[model samples]
Target: MSTLPLLGAAMTVAELEGLQDFILSRDRDLELQDFCELGALDADWKPAAERAKALLQGYKGRLGIHGPFWGFTIASGDVEIQKVVTRRMRQGLEICDFLGATQMVIHSPYLTWDYNNLDNHPGRKAYQNFLDYTHATLDPVIAYAEKIGVTMVVENIMDKDPDIRRILVEDFNTKALAVSIDTGHAHYAHGSTGAPPVDYFVRRAGNSLQHIHLQDADGYADRHWNIGEGNISWAAVFRALGELTSNPRLILELRNKSGILPSVDWLKARGLAE
Candidate 1:
């Protein structure tokens, strides 16, 4: 029999009562990847952990957790800022343990204000500084992840190119340190610049892609619209996945602001579902 094709939804259940809705609606075999909302380094993460555990109790499908997004950076050049970000992310990791989440997604740091002074924005030294700091800081986190039995997957930014992404992957060589290829980010990275086509990233990352943040993108901003709401050629993407030796976990990374379920149904009607 063919391996059961798996699909995941990015939903955070930060309350015990929400499990009923999540389980009733979600597919029994499908994964549920949480988009944790612990944005700051405040001491409000205890409730987040409680909620994740309650919702995931006896959950039949796989579990993955997205680390906090707002005001957190793992690649900061400033040691104090990096320490705060690390503390915040460690809370998310603790939540992963509670929910039995095996995968966690994280973002790299942006440039410091000093970058504004550079003649070439995103200059070699600036990028090198970011990379140097990221590699050093993340080493401890990687060790912590292994100790806790979770793989931390780094995501692609909307402005990065395949070359930079290659460095991101090659610089931190490990199966646990994989890519979270965001579709909208791919369009943004390639649409404005004359970079290689988006698929170049997919093929280059190859088997190292642990998860995908699937969404359609207009020529401009990341619409986060459902499958065909924009111009993204998702059919081609699935076709490419079919050719791969193994497929990464396809996570529908759309906003949950109503209408998303319907759009998912629309994608299902178009044969995007397994």
Candidate 2:
């Protein structure tokens, strides 16, 4: 019997209520998104975490969480800011531990501007500085992740150079770290920023790509539209994914949470996903 690929949705705690059966029917991967807000995590997270457990009862699937990403960058050069980012990310790890999640999505620090200018400084020192700051921020988190058996998948945001995140993950040289690609973000970069196409991002990341945010976009903003709603080449992207040895969690990250299953059906209809 052929094993089906890991496929699922990124949903908040409340969104799981109406979609639990649909999700469990698929019985694959899931990414909890409620813990990404710093204020909410600080105010109180136990209630939501408990509710998530209740809602996810009988769900036997790979679980992950979207870590804190608002109002801060993980690669902030400021020492104080780096400390705060580290703390918030640790809290995210706490949630992962509490929920037994084995994966957490962390946004990449690579920016579009850094692609051409990272070499501007003498001997590529600017890129080295970015790496230094990023490492300082993530090392602690990666250590805890390794201890708890979680893989920190760094997601690409405004990353124009696909090799950058892949190289960073390789530099970490730990199973605790991997790559994540957001199709909409890649498409936006391809059309709007002259970067390579979405499939190229998948191909570049190669086996290091452990998690993927599948969505559609008009090659403009991060629309996060449902699959087939925009212009992404689903067939080509899935073809590239089919070549990967890594069994990545293909999670549909749509703006409208209601579109999760419909998008799955869309992919299924096109024979791109099961």
Candidate 3:
């Protein structure tokens, strides 16, 4: 376990101010939590982007942005809603291009309820509808991402069936599509909704897993606490990661930005991460 597992933090520009030197020394799997609001990428975007670029002038790391995910669904069958979602995605790409980011996080549309209902219909018409609408909504953005060398990693939100996203990425059949796991999200679903455990998510995602949000949470909610503060088996999670060839970016996503270092220390003390 002392193999020096790569780990980094997901934070805003302000939070990164004093921590730049630390990140410079560790794994550079940095994820920027900016421009993730419903309309944050429009007029109120440039100043923050410029500030972040200036702050990270000499930082050479794998950079990613949390794509706009609030108040929109990519699997919407409504033509107008699709247009809105498409605009947000394009806007996110604009920021990614400016910041030289290679990855963007998009939330999955598969709800916990979908497991039972999606296949209940004859011939799985409901599942087919979800796939059809999702493809229609994302095809153009994914094409643009591919052309520009950016990978759009589909993140599990309320997704209980781990295979659904893998199948969606395979169906798309493009280099731009990949999988992302938020540990806290999986843990919450595992305890509350009967979803598989976090370690199972890692195994299920397999080589397609491109990014992970490294947060610890009680099974009660998406607590986003520092690692070692939750009931999740850190050893089990690391063991699962050990079997992966993807080398996914592990970004500590905590609500309290100052918890990043302590979380890393917890993992390091246990010989699970460095």
Candidate 4:
């Protein structure tokens, strides 16, 4: 049985510094999401990175990053768009290097509408086009990440099923590329796009599963509520995760910093963590 450490997603540098004691007290890790956005890698990042490093000094837990996903698609078919996306991702990798983060989470380019529209095309050609574009877009980014020793984990946002995501990771066939499942996104996909249950993602990713965003949703929208505050099936999800040979980092991606401790307590009370 592979057990994963509980992690907290700090949306800002100040919040992470404020909660440093609380996070380390529970032996949890940190996944910094603030610097992973576009335009965030500017001059201000230097000071923020310094502050984060100072705050995390002597912290023994592993670190991860939620890479930039807004305003960019890594699998864009347009060359210019792909270039911009890759540029932002390369910046994200620079931040990862600064923080010594081993794993970086990126949004998967598989959209539900795009996948569904494949039926309108002739005989998997649309699928092939998507694959080709994704490969073209991500290959350079993956190469850079490998050079810096950062594992790029593509997360599911609009994917209605695991097949596309699984295929995307396997197609790369590199150790630097893997899958990340955001529980709230999976729940939303299930309700809005008829996606498989949340457990299906864990089961399908299996060994390739490298990261997780553990949040609860009402199954209608991405609520990002604390665990036990919504309708997600925690027991089923953890059961599936227990079968994985690889231990994926599980981060509590709550909407606010205040929910972090309560969410940790909630998981402990339910035996999801120690």
Candidate 5:
């Protein structure tokens, strides 16, 4: 297998230094996943912005960006919600430009409101309507991303079906729009014995897998377990990746509150991070 690139989910500026330390001081393979604070846009966020930029410039590692999931709803049918989503998406893309982020990760809007519980689910007509609205709302944002040379990666969420990824990639009809497969979310939705039939997904996605968020989980729930702590077979996954020859950005989107460095260390000890 080709060398798999590693990355840390830098949800805060403080985490970037740790990532730098891991890659440089420890000789570990890693990159940085920038998780920008959308709420800080109105605040004096320039310092964080500068720090993020510095990490991108100094770290000698590939960069990826995760957009704010709480406030942004790119698929909202409501006009007001759509406006907010567009504004936030534009802001996030601008941040990506500054950070030189190759991919911008986005969460599909949660099922809310009256028709919210009905988006391409159960394969019904109402769900199809919801899908149409979502595609309509996201086209402008996708165009904007293309103009700036950024790939917009819509992620899978809890209770989301696997087919949605295929639907989005096929319907969007743009390289700028792609999928950020979140292993944790997929495990939460599917049984967590292993990945969500990733071999099938990889084939279905073809070249649309722009990025990946790797975390482990048990069949019971999505625990964001470190690389070796859960039922996942990293070696097997890497084996598939080798066959596919699609080395999408592999970001370690684990629970950083604890177990983050230990996970890196575990991979290092096994020569997985070399």
Candidate 6:
């Protein structure tokens, strides 16, 4: 048995309802993104949380959760919005505790639109303000996550370069704070922002790279196709990953359940995963 970094796929609660055998048979870990949405957080999250716990009843492998991000901005200029984001994320951490999830993925709020507008304001001052605001909003959540022993991995969503995320993770300077690189997002950033190739994210985050959403994309949209269905250089990307000293969780984040096994088979055939 090869002890390669745990390979898995993202799944919703609905998707896993009747597909436990199909999912657990192929992957060693599950990145639960369904419970991270706003609607699921309503009603004290009781119903959803109970369902999630039931779903993982007998599975022994690791579990991860993607934190609530849609319509929420952790680094927003609006104070009320920041409050809502923190509240929802704290709920996410609570869910992590209930599910025994050691890692949780939070999407980075950094956006190219904000970066572009920075020039109109002042020298790096605007960017610095954004970082400060983000830290202030997430500091308490990060503290709680640390206390609960959950690694809060921030995933790159709209970052033009890895520097912004690297800075955010390094500023916290804690084992609990790390980066989650999404291959499809990196490819999109490369095309949209002229950022470095997808592998650069791995190299830049290095040991701090704690999680990965491995998916293929056509450099234009977040297609989330099967591993070999897009143009990303998997060999180069995996080569960079192989150099990392940290054993990051590699979760194939295909958009559809149908693409999961094919993605797994693609990697297994190339000896990239066990």
Which candidate leads in lDDT?
A: 2
Query: RMSD, each candidate, Å?
Result: 4.1, 1.3, 1.4, 2.0, 4.1, 2.1
lDDT by residue for model 3 (1-274), tens: 3477778788887777878877777437788887896557765788888988887777788889999899888899998899888888888888899888899999999898898788788996898788888888888788889887899899988988988888888888888889999999999989989999999999999999999998899887999998888999889999999999898999899988788889888998888888
Q: Over the stretch 68-155, how does candidate 5's per-residue lDDT look in tens digits?
A: 6675556666877777767777777777776666677888653323223564366676656656666766766788788778887778
Q: Which runs in model 2 stand beyond 4 Å of their true positions?
A: 1-6
lDDT of 6 at 71: 79
**Candidate 6 lDDT tens digits, 118-183:** 678757788788788888778878888988889988898988868778788888788878889999
Model 4 ranges off by over 4 Å? 1-7
lDDT against the true structure, per candidate, is 0.63, 0.89, 0.87, 0.82, 0.63, 0.83
Stretches off by above 4 angstroms in model 3 are none
TM-score of 5: 0.79
All candidates' TM-scores?
Answer: 0.79, 0.97, 0.96, 0.94, 0.79, 0.91
- Please give me the total number of clashing residue pairs in predicted model 3: 0
Q: What tens digits encode model 2's per-residue C-alpha lDDT throughout 4-76?
A: 3546999898999888887788577889999887587778899999999988888889999998899888789
Model 1 misplacement above 4 A:
1-4, 14-41, 110-128, 194-197, 257-260
For model 1, state the Cα shift of residue 211 in Å: 0.8
TM-score of 2: 0.97
Q: List the residue pairs that clash in candidate 3.
A: none
TM-score for candidate 4: 0.94
**How well is each residue in 1-274 modelled by candidate 4, as lDDT tens digits?**
5254465564577888778887667556678877766668664787887888888888777688788888878778899898877777788888889888888888888888876787788898888887788888778788878887888888998888787777878888888888899999999988878888899988988889978899999878989998889988998999898898788888888897788888878877788774
For candidate 4, give the lDDT of residue 206.
88
What would the C-alpha RMSD of candidate 1 be, to one decimal place?
Answer: 4.1
1 against 6, candidate with superior TM-score? 6
Greater-TM-score candidate between 1 and 3: 3
What is the clash tally of candidate 2?
0
Query: Backbone collision count in every prediction?
Result: 0, 0, 0, 0, 0, 0
